[model samples]
Target: MTYPKRFAALPEYAFPRLRSLLDHHDPGGDVVHMTIGEPKHAFPSWVGDVLAENTAGFANYPPNDGSPELLGAISDWIKRRYDVGLDLNQIMALNGTREGLFNAAVALCPEETARGERPVVLIPNPFYQVYAVATATVGAEAVFVPATAETGHLPDFASLPPQILNRAEICYMCSPANPQGAVADRDYWAKLIALAEKYDFRIFADECYSEIYRDTPPPGALEVAQEGGADPERVVLFNSLSKRSNLPGLRSGFVAGGPETIRHIRQLRAYAGAPLPLPLQRVAEKVWADEAHVEENRALYREKYKVADEVFAGIDGYMPPDAGFFLWLPVEDGEAAALKLWTETGVRVLPGAYLSRDTDRGNPGKQYIRVAMVAPKQEMRDGLTRLRDCIYA
Candidate 1:
């Protein structure tokens, strides 16, 4: 049997690969998972009560787009957070970020660029896997740009050759990046938007971790787009309750952009989108409207940040992340380090190479391991101490 050529270049997903590398061995001690950025913190205490009250709505087919109340909540959140107001037509709730991040490419990426060349999707190395899969689904060329320590762990898309930029149609950017946790600054967003304006491409800004920062709130793409007077359609913003409210299981998120761009996305949502269940939608509305829970969640992450800094202090190459919950710690070889850490200390982590692709310059993630800071404070400290004594010490 033959498969589509598009996915032929794609590698196996990350977690299964990690399992293959570590699961066969007996754990050396009490298992402490420092892999997978699944938030172990508590979610809003009211979420259950809200879900119970809205259970009747579950019987009906949920709104194909977000429910009116949910969209209103999302709009108000955007206005409050990004200072970019949006009409009802400009926003749609997603099952979670993965669906929007993938489907938007299917809806928005052109088959061919204006230059009549195959469309190129610029993806940051060590990216959330959905971006590359989305590019493949669209049959576009996926150009993997390095987001290394040298580049401040953000993709330098502006450095790409004119030819690559000219053929580009979509660029996936994650602020408060997943594994590395590097937040894109306002200046970075402005420059990327300008580059998109000049080259005729769209920016897919995934800000799922926007609320999990240590100090200042990260500047958002839409915020910069509006201030710089870039096209309203230039950036498609994706954020969710997953990290912000510790509601990853809630599977609630939204994509917002220009009305025309959103119309195209909503058209696809009508067909292939998995709209959030209506009860979940009601909960999402309530959660989006409230900031108290999010602030409390950020405080927890800030404590984790302090723990990481204190643990890894004086370790060479241990630059702390600006935001998000993962620590991309430097190692001699990611797989070897991860395996040794697991077998010797029972601290499980993901090898950085699993999250990145090999390029002409070689795999940028080859010498690193991504440790999730999502565990409890004391457990994380224990895990980090074991990992350091095992791998780095």
Candidate 2:
């Protein structure tokens, strides 16, 4: 049997690779998982009530794009959060932002540049794996740009050559980034928007971790785009209730952009999409409208942030994340540190190199490990203490 070679270059996903690396080894101590970013917080107490009320709707097929109620709720949230008014047509409900992130490229990335060249898709190194898979699936040249400590953990897309920028169709960026927790400020968004406008490309802003910040809410790409008066189609924003509402299993998210861009996404989704069950859509509608639970959730993460800072304090190269839950701690070698921690301390972490691709300068994540703070406060503290003593000591 033959398989498509499009994905031939991709490595086994981060978790599977991790299992292969450590599952066979006997853990040296009590196990404390600090790997995956899956949030362990309690979701709103009313989710079950809402699901019960809407259970009957499950018998019916959900709207392909989204129920009118769900879309309206998402639009209202966007307006409240970003201060940008958007018609319901400008948004499409997604199973999760991950699904939308991958499919948006299929729906919107042009087959070829206007100059008849294969388009380039810019991705930040140490990126969410979906970006590279999406780029390769679309047959675009995937240009991995470094987002190391030197660059403040955000990719400097403007530094690329004019030739690469000219053929660029999309760039994937995560603010309150996954492993590094760097948030893009207004100036960063403004410059990126200007670059996109000058080069005729779209920006896929993955804001899944946008709600888990420590202090002032991180500025959003959509809000910044509106301020700059850039083409709405040029900035496609993807967000989710996973981090915001502590409802990762709820699998609720949305993609919002200009009407034309959404039209294409909706068209592709109509054929290939699995609409959230009507019951789940009803649950999402209510979830988007409620911020009390979200605020409570953010407060918990804020407390955890303090715990992390206190734990890693006085450790060199320890940068407390500006926002988001992960701590990208510097190490001599990510894989080696992770293996040592797992075997000696039984506190599992993901090697930074697993999240990044190798390039000429070397993989930016090669010398670090990503530690998620989603466990309960005391448990997280205990794990971090063990990790610090076992590795940093």
Candidate 3:
């Protein structure tokens, strides 16, 4: 039997590959899990009450696009957070940003761009796996740009060859980027939006980690686009309650952008997607309308950031991320460091290489390890102390 070849060449998913590497080893001490970025913070107290109140809605089929209340909440949140206006038709509730991130490619990417080519989708080298899969799903060229320490942990899309940029259809950028914790500033978003307008491509900005920052909130792509007078049709922003409200299990998120782009996405989704249940949509509306819980959650991440800073201070090549909750620590070889740490200290972590791909120059993540600061404050500190001593010492 023949199978689709598009995914046949993809690298193994990171976690399974990690299990293959260290599953057999027994830790010498209490096992501390610093691998996945699952939040350890408490969710809003009202979530339960809202879910209970709306339990009756679960008896019937839910709206696919989103309930009017939920859509209004999303629109209100966008206006409050980014000062960007989005009509109900311009926003569609997502199962999660992961779904939006992948499905947007299928909906937005053209078979051919201005250059009359298969079009290239610009992806960061150590990027979220979904981006590349989305690019390949559309039968476009997946061009991996290096987001290395040298580049402030963000890809320089402007550096690409003019020919590639001209044919570019979509570029996936993550702010307070996953694994790296690098936030895109106003200038970064402005420049990328300009490039997207100049080349006639769309910007898929993953702002899921937008609420988990240290000091000031990270600037968003849509905000910059509006300020710069770029076409609203040129950008789509994805946000989630996962990191923001500590509700990854809720699978609640939204995609907001130009009316036409979102209309296309909603049209495609109606045929292939299961919308958030009415009950869950009620919970989401309340979640977005309230900001107190989000502020409390951000404070928790801030505490963890302080712990990371204190633990790794004076250590060479240790940089505390500006935002997000992952530490991309430098090492000789990520896999070797992870193995040594697990066997010696019983702390588990993910190799940076697993998060990235090898390019013509090199795998930028090959020399680092990704430590998620998602454990509790005490456990986070303990894990970092153990990791620092075992891996860096």
CA lDDT for candidate 3? 0.91
On lDDT, the candidate that comes out on top is 2
Candidate 3 steric clashes: 0
Worst 10 residues of 1 by lDDT: 2-11
> Where is the poorest 10-residue window by lDDT in model 2?
21-30
lDDT of each: 0.93, 0.94, 0.91
Comparison by lDDT, 1 against 2, better one: 2
> Candidate 3's residue-wise lDDT over 1-393, tens digit each?
998988876899999999999998888689999999898889988799999999999898998999999999999999999898888999999999999999999998898875678889999989999998888788999999999888999999999999899888899999988889999999888888888888888999999999988889899998899999988788899999998999999999999999999999998898988799999999999999999998888888888888999999999999889999899999999999999999998899999999998889999999999998998899889999999898778
lDDT of 1 by residue, 258-320 (tens): 999999999999888778899999999999999998898898889988988998899999979
Ranked candidates, highest lDDT first = 2, 1, 3
Residues 1-393 of candidate 2: C-alpha lDDT, one tens digit per residue: 999998999988999989988999989798999999999999999999999998999789889999999999999999999899999999999999999999999998888999999999999999999999999899999999999889999999999999999999999999989889999999999999999999999999999998888889999999999999999899999999998988899899999999999999999998998999999999999999999999999999989999999999999999999898899999999999999998998999999999999999899999999999989999999999999998889
- Candidate 2 lDDT at 194 equals 98
lDDT of 2 at 287: 96
